[model samples]
Target: MAGRLRVVGVRVERVSGRVAVVVSLGYDGAVVTGRADRATGETQTIQVAAEAVLEAIRQVAPGQTRWGLEQVAIQPMLGGPAVVAHILLEAEGTSEHLIGSALGRSGPLEEAAAEAVLDAVERRLGWFTKN
Candidate 1:
């Protein structure tokens, strides 16, 4: 185990005439992925990435811990631009907001978006590992 879930792969494909982004996250033994389709005229680039990562997280999360991707965007900042992800965590009648970011130039934007999502949930999901 690498002590946390890592982005195993991120890629885009065309499915049924729609563009889809697939994000895969995994530990050592098992891998899970989620996919989101982009509709025509969609403007937000990272929305599909966020949604795909959220779906992937849900597949491995414990019961009753709901994760929501409120917003995701790429913004310019000091030391180069970055992709930011806003996450909402709801569990046990409590809710917490978390934010994570990754440098946009470090990798492909779709891949960076997935990594940012993992950053947002890393602490919460770190304790759970593959058996």
Candidate 2:
């Protein structure tokens, strides 16, 4: 594990009533990409984005504690729509819940979703991404 990872890119696509999200995370010049897809729905975009972030983390840094996305949504806030993410952290006989949010800012909803998930774990990612 290294330090905290940052969202570098997010790509979202909708085709044939299916939604796909890819989240790219950067750490120490290494970029990892995670992907998720589900049938399109009201909140499926955020759901896939959140799941993709967790997938990317697992790809580069395995054998760590557990990280599970509980919920994700984009709702009106801060004068605009904001993506909110709720996550469950499980580690060594302990568990904690974390919440994070980021404004949509007229960007791709997936971008906000990625940032929201990262924000949720910002403070506690020292070990999770430590190099």
Q: Judged by TM-score, which candidate is best?
A: 2
Instruction: Give each model's whole-structure lDDT.
Output: 0.81, 0.84
Instruction: Single out the weakest 10-residue window by summed lDDT for candidate 1.
Output: 122-131
Candidate 2 ranges with C-alpha deviation above 4 Å: 1-3, 129-131
Best by lDDT: 2
Count of backbone clashes, every candidate in sequence: 0, 6
Q: Please state every model's RMSD to the true fold in angstroms.
A: 2.6, 2.1
- The residue pairs in collision within model 2 are 1-130, 1-131, 2-129, 2-130, 2-131, 3-129
Rate residue 91 of model 1 by lDDT.
81
For candidate 1, the TM-score is: 0.85
Candidate 2 local accuracy as lDDT? 0.84
lDDT of 2 at 96: 95
* Residues 83-109, model 2: lDDT tens digits: 999999887789999999999898877
